[model samples]
Target: MNRKTLVLPAVIGLLAPVLAACGGTDGGSDGGGAIAVGTTDRFIATADAPAPLDPAYAYDVGSWNILRQTVQTLMIQPRGEGEPVPEAAESCTFTDTGNERYVCKLREGLKFADGNPVTAKDVKYSIDRALAIKADSGVSALLSTIDTVEAQGEREVVFHLKTADATFPYKLSTPVAGIVNPADYDKGKLRDGFEVSGSGPYKLEAKVENDEMVSAVFTKNADYKGALTVNNDKAEIRSFKDADAMDAALQNGDIDVMSRTLTPEQIKKLSIDPGENVELIDMPGLEIRYLAFNTDAPGVKDKAVRQAMAQVVNRSELVSKVYGSQAEPLYSLVPATITGHSNSFFNEYGDPSTDKAESLLAKADVTTPVKLTLHYTTDHYGAATKQEFEVLQKQLNASGLFDVTIKGTPWDSFVPAQRKGSYEVWGMGWFPDFPDADNYLAPFLDDDNFLKSPYANSVIRNTLIPASRREPDRGSAATSLTEIQDIVAEDVPVLPLWQGKQYVAARDDITGTAYVLNSSSTLQLWELGRGVSG
Candidate 1:
């Protein structure tokens, strides 16, 4: 869809006043012989609490989820679609022939939860702060296309780009573009602590951090002016040591909802006998799990070794046996739902065959019995990760072509270690920042990538990606995407494993279970509420 034509110039002028005066409705019943609806605390999960709650420093999924609820962006992705619509802004347009200059007009009378007025300057300052900090895992890379951000008067903000990018609007819809109050934050430094000041649907009431476990309580923001209506007055998000503890809490009625990091077996059991207390809600598969090979490492440096591992690894078995129907085999770095995705790995290697793998190794003059180490995180992805790695170890060693050793670590250390090239081969998962093919290709294939592996292909990095981004019609970028995937399959820097199906298990009384999960796989906390039947 072409988002450039989504909003018209005249409609923006007409809607500015109406949107500013539109405040949230009174949430679920307050009590006094009525259902204790708004007063109920809705509990959810995060693998861990995001270290610094500053929008500029928060990049992980856990942090982004929290920020998405507490912060407001210029544009937002509505339920069931990837196209961004006006959120805080009344309207946004390109305003230039080259698609390099983007202009957004803020709605009238916008105010933070603290009752401070939100102006164009706060929006510009928030983005400028993110670029200034440039944290290792920060959102600076996503905003690298912007050359300048200027606030023209109170309501209008303009962005000048270094190059033409059709997908620039999608980037602004992410948490990276969350507008913060400039008076509460310094432009040069990241704001410390978990307390936040935002104008989204909810405001942070309190944050309590106890060792590795952390919890945050949110209440409906009276000053929030946006499309979303807060259904519940208060919500709680807690991080557990593992999925087991989180699931147990859900079963005992201590927590109202549970999502992410549930094992396949746990999901199956919950689905079979969910009881009258809870219900399991299944979401579309928009996430991918993969194995990344450190190309600079010793045994993994050879192309033949990487290719052999790709050939012999049984994805079908991995999905069927380990993940059950919760996931499906993925043959490309890009998931099937996205445009330009192809089964390049499957077409090149076919079904798992030991003979083909051995032949490929022999053709490259590599000696038999190649020894390799594979690393994975125990507490990061889920409880199933350990079993998944064991299954992989068994599959590779059974072929007699290689000897694999398995190592496990916690998420706290795994991320930094992997980025430092500490593992020869490792497991990783990706949840898209935005629902675009570029999100899949650019982050992993670029010269300076998130993986921090020594992989540089000038053609794919310099030519194909740039050409693809310049296309106004995303579908027309298919050819470049196909070429990029083909190059990835041949090189095998990272092997595609499977695409996951999102599951959110919540009490049956929750009214908006299905509506909470958006197309980008983010939870819209405002959509959740305890029904009157409860």
Candidate 2:
């Protein structure tokens, strides 16, 4: 994919990947029938919970991959563009100078796959219903700033914000903003079962599930009205329990393309010497991994204790031994790609040093050999996690400053463990809801934070965040953003570990794998086709 420097409406810097330019000079790929894609990602809440296809309840990559193809948002990031272009709407903008009031006018003749009219009222219902349900596992926190949404006539929709938020436009481009048919979705509950009625290029033709989503079949919707181009007539998405199965599926020609949850070894193999018919496509990755501390937990509650542990963990060594070439060391909350990125952790804690850690603990009068448990998910993150945590245990134990125990839990249970405070410190990861400095910092700082932390700083929560959000030009807010990182480094609520590099492995003949992810990193299945691009 060709990289383009795009300055978004908020004036933040982005290295957007141009899929259109790389697809072909004439633009787009040759006509194809259907493409089968495979992954080892989990989408549903559980076997007994709501349907994984419901946009209102879905939050993970597996769910978003399907939702982004079938559902249409008010605005969308065009192929490789950082800023959003109108999709369901003809145009959208902030009407007020304070950036508190936003307005959108619907596109003419828009209709859902079910042939239902796409109206402003349905838009209101979609957003309002999501907020009303407010599922703990849902995307409510992302839209917490929205105070209310109202429909004006049949074409216009107005969003009233609780406070100034200049980056609201980027948030609208995410899959959580995906619109659904009001007649099908519940008002204050998640719609169970796999049927989906959307307005995007494809409809969920059939969805199969056993314990989790097994497979889903999507076919292009003739009634669909949107800005996206449908290159293939149909797309089949398959799920696997492990990377080995997905990798074998790709190798055996059972699946056309495989992504997400590819092991580091598999990535290395595909990157170096792919099979005769295989190809590797690399894209900029914003996914980051870190360890979040339960600030109230014993042995890790002290600021000095957290800082001492941070001083000893070598990020470079961790990534090298655990992730290999697939990841790089991360030193701050915001990724290096976004504006206002800082290496606060590196600046504060230079290299792995036991002397420094020992001194800090001594000054704080902390007891030696602090007992701690490091928790990681056995299934959700991938096979590398158990080894990653074991390496972490070795590093901490070698310092002789802590007695560590490593524990593994399945994702379905790991989520509940965090809520129950089952672990003192645990592995957590984030692929920004949208690419912005605010997206990285705001969620953790706010009261509705996903951090599950007792750590609080008034300056970060009350001052720096609000000040940054008030600035219309996000780049100008760099001072505040950097200050937030600096403060986080000092506090050590979460210790940054590593940032992943994105790679997509596919057969050489498959087209638009480079174009699959838009500016926001949501998979656009319509971009995929059988033959090479024109």
Against the true structure, whose TM-score is highest?
2
Question: Deviation in angstroms for 313 in model 1?
Answer: 0.6
Candidate 1 residue-wise lDDT, 351-445, digit = tens: 99999999999999989799988899877678888888999999999999999999999776777788777899999888888888898888888
Minimum summed lDDT over a 10-residue window in model 2 is located at 3-12
Per-candidate Cα lDDT values, in order, are 0.77, 0.80
* TM-score list, all predictions: 0.89, 0.93
User: Which tens-of-lDDT digit does each residue in 201-220 have in candidate 2?
Assistant: 88886555555567878888
- For model 2 the TM-score comes to 0.93
Residue 528 in model 2: shift from native, Å? 0.5
* Top candidate when judged by lDDT against the true structure: 2
Candidate 2: clashing pairs of residues: none
